[model samples]
Target: MREIFIERRDRILRIAVKEKGQLYECFIEEEEERNEPLCGEIYKGRIKNIVPAISAVFVDIGHKRDAQMNMKKGRTYKQGDEVIVEVLTEQIGNKGAKVTEEYSVAGRYAVLTVNRQGLSVSRRIKDERIINNLKNELVLPNDVAVTIRTSAEDTDVLHVNKEIDSIYEKICDINEKSKYILKPQRVYGENSLLHKVLIDNINNQTSKIVVDSKDDYELIKKYIGDEDEIDVILHEDYRTMFDYYGIEREIVSLRHNTVNLKNGGQIVIDKTEALYAIDVNSSKNISHGNKFDTAKNTNMEAAYEIGKQVRLRNLSGMIIVDFIKMRDDKDKADVLNALRKAFYNDKTNTRIYPFTELDLVQISRRKKGKSIYSYIEEKCEACDGHGKRLKLSYIENLIRNEILRVEGENAINDFYIELSEHYEKSVKGDIFTFLKEIEGITKNIYLNFVPGIDSFKVEPLLFKKQVENLAKYKVNNIEFC
Candidate 1:
């Protein structure tokens, strides 16, 4: 059975996809990660400089760094001209966002593209009648084109039409918004993460969806309206939804370097500046049969697990895998086939090459964003950059979890957490904004700033009324947070 769990926390949103209680994929988005507009976002930009040699132009989209857009052959534009552009790639390091003039809006069942002129059906949709019916039933604008997605095969025509209408209306709104704006700024953007998970994973095989936020539940309900085959559940619990469902521990397990298979096999993953390396070992999974049989069985299991780990960790770029040595070419072929089937449904563009003479397999995947480690960890100064330490945001989350645990165990809802100035500076907004959700359950939570402290300390307040009356008063040179 396939299930999706959506959890919303302070400054973060997490989505997990599981099959038979095993985590298949995880996606996390934080508020601070949105400092730049994500890929596929639309912006009305002002042309800044043109580079004729590369056929690209620089655009000012109201960001500190200017974006770059490639010009089509026969398209001409001068500086200070206004144009509509879509972000094709995110900004990396010193590079600006890569954009395109061609705009597109993707829906669950179809995608509408500008400056393209064709009605194309997905290769997966092989039914002649369905293809012909969609071609005849759908009506689009003369200038725009539409592509029928694989999910549209068994879908109702009216729903597809409704999505087209919705997309066109959105396009109209963007045009309307851009007409009056003389400056470069964002015109429209989609919450791509949630929509992507829903569109890609929640299909005919999806059995259940559990979301903690009511607003997310409503959005999902509207997206998958009247789908009686799947269950949409709203998680209402005092404990965090991820913790209640045992997904929190599973997510933490991804940080480990070794993965143990069900049959006593092991896959060890390591990364360097060059490429990610995976080693498969038979370990205790040796069978009573010959060496080839033992190696084949373990390698086959490891192949499947490696693909799952790649998606879970978002491992991209060049990757190398070393499987247990096998003599028979047929066994190697079988192991390779298993690995291919594992990544058959992966959305990212991945290319797998044949096994080399030494039996190392090479796989290349397009990079989307930073890896899971980059988001959650930082270089450890104490270890001289050889190790990684959790980021301050994650530490803040641990503090929040500790606060929740204390509130759950004790009867009092009044408490104050003391943090050093170094830790307090990491917080972006008001302390109440960070702890308000906790305060809703804990009633009143206060922050006490103490100097020279390494981390944080949480203590209960005996006199809640007295503490509130003396609001901003400093006691022994400690200020309130």
Candidate 2:
């Protein structure tokens, strides 16, 4: 099992992931910003529609993804019912949210999935006899239910009960205030980013805790003591932490498209306005062995990385994975299963379909707003609405980079650089600069600057190449490629 660590700065909490005694990945929360997530937030809401056919009611939860209630799924309610819903999945574009009436407010100790049955255990919890005794020993409220969180493995009832009571009081106050609302409004919200990080993630791996701000360190320590037995010592000097540790360098690596795998292959993710695409390739230099072995080697790494990317990127909506095809059916099954297993921790509801006739794995994750990556990079004001530049300067940059990549290579003696005039000028000058940067790297550069919706080449240069190879507007040109 993997362990998660947390570092809270300002209102953003950073979650660090590690496995087998080594740091693997991290999730950063910038809650002070407007783009912060409200998914899994619970609030009191009123029913908008009760679709008996689909068995879902459109609920008006406070922020977004107006909760969708599947009639048969959870507690039964009516058209005008005022109920509590925990956001299951976030709002994806115009689509509404998937919600459940069983609400839960989590703390450092346990999660409160309220208004239902009894305490349940995580399926991953082994030593079933011990799990059963823990369940049988715990006293559950008649009107509520809870899924004793993964962190509560050996925790005592006093601690769990205290959290349950605290949550009850807070929720009760919110409910009382919500009664005054003539219509539905978001009354309850997530805790401070630091509190949330500590509550949801325990510091299971990190050997040390360092803090720049006294308040942040105190807050984290308070949660750590309350949640588990671990003692977290705070190093007050944050400058020392950043400079002494490799955090700054590691964070820079996280922002890039390429990710290295344990076995051999690499996962290159590309995104677009319409969809997301993942390419799993065996970086041949690291390949484990023969053709079949190479394909399997790469596929396994891809499967594991695929899950991590989906979570770290918070990528939602349709996702397609182009895996290195394997001849053996068992190999294909193994890879598919690995991909699914990796995603088990993802709270979002994801659907993965089997490989298509083309040997492609199709995944659909709901995405509504700008991806996590886009938030870090400012957009070009010139693109009008998009971040990419179809103008000559931008396309010219891509051409230059491609040429520099192929320079002096025995393979690919020549390439036709087909591009529009807008892109040619915008992208070409950058090529000049790049060629200057790399000596003896020059080749023939062709330019195509035709008008009439030059969507094929220009779009790929921007959106499609991002990962999904997707275009908002379908291009009819095969000539450019």
Candidate 3:
């Protein structure tokens, strides 16, 4: 059975879709802290400047940075002219949000476009008769355009027409209100996360919708009103919706660098600033009969897993995958085909190229938001995220150098050296042996241990007269230095 589970935890809303008990898709949204997604939101923007060289213009939309809009042919605007714009993509990293003069409002069964003419059907719906019938039924104005959605294929003719008309009415209302707005402001906001999910997935096969929030459950009920065929249940159990469906475990597993396949193979996913590199490795013990067959099977398995991981982690931008080597040309073709098929259901726009000369498969996906890893994990401070620290021997050498430097002065009767617990424990024997070498010069070498210290600290012992003169001095928690 297909089901969608929604849960709200600590101001974060998590939604997961399952097909036959396996997670197919997952999404997360911060309820209290994050700004609502700006994509598909309509705003009145004032053009700030026009860059003729790049054919793009900057507009002020009340954000910290001005949004960028691409200029089309035969379009002209002054510096202070106010125009309607829709956010195409949210601001990513240092780049500003991308906005467009052309905008469309999407509904469950169709999308209405402003100032454009024609009815276009979703490419996924291939029935010529259904397409023609939808085209004939849609009665829209000459200036307005509509695109029939795939969900309209099985919907009733009256319902489809009504939905189209309803969306057209909303568009007309917006146009009517646009003339009265005097300043740059938001005219329309995109649908809520729950509403968008339901609109996108509510079809004939959707069986159940489970939610942990009673208020959200009631809101969904109000949206669906009389859709009794699809059961929208309010989960009252103590276990979280994510835990109940094993989504939490699945999400946690994606944080690891390596993912193991069922056939004993593994794929290592590494993300860099420029691109993501995925390396597929085959196990030593062959699961399949021949080497080529084993490589092909592992490549095929990795292709599907790679697709799932990309979506689960919300990874975007350039990606390169290095599959297990296969000798036959047919094997390479089959693996590429498998990868293309795996991303067929992905909502994000993705393009996969054929294997290159270096046997690498390249992929590019549209980036919308931060990846799941960045949201969940932070950079380590100790090793500056490099995941390695100085060796104990190196630290010991530095300590010895400091001790020798103090002994060179010829004024120290005794001295104390502080080291981290880890360094002290690891080099206890080394410290004793090194002290024996300098026994004649200063037999009063003192070692002190401190917690969480990354490097060594040195302090020379002062005489009784010197300590009395510096009344407020303390050394290693002792009264006298």
lDDT leader = 1
lDDT string for model 1 (66-127, tens) is 99988788887899999888887778778899888788888888888877777888877989
TM-score of candidate 3 against the unseen true structure: 0.76
Candidate 2, residues 186-224, lDDT tens digits: the string is: 566645434554565554543444555567667666656
TM-score: the better of candidates 1 and 3: 1
Task: Say what the RMSD of model 1 is.
Answer: 5.8
- Candidate 1 lDDT at 277 equals 99
Per-model root-mean-square deviation over C-alphas: 5.8, 12.5, 14.3
User: TM-score of every model?
Assistant: 0.81, 0.65, 0.76
* Candidate number with the higher lDDT (1 or 2): 1
Q: Order of all candidates by TM-score, from best down to worst?
A: 1, 3, 2
Which candidate would rank higher by lDDT, 2 or 3? 3
lDDT of 3: 0.74
Error of 2 at 467 (Å): 43
lDDT of each: 0.80, 0.60, 0.74
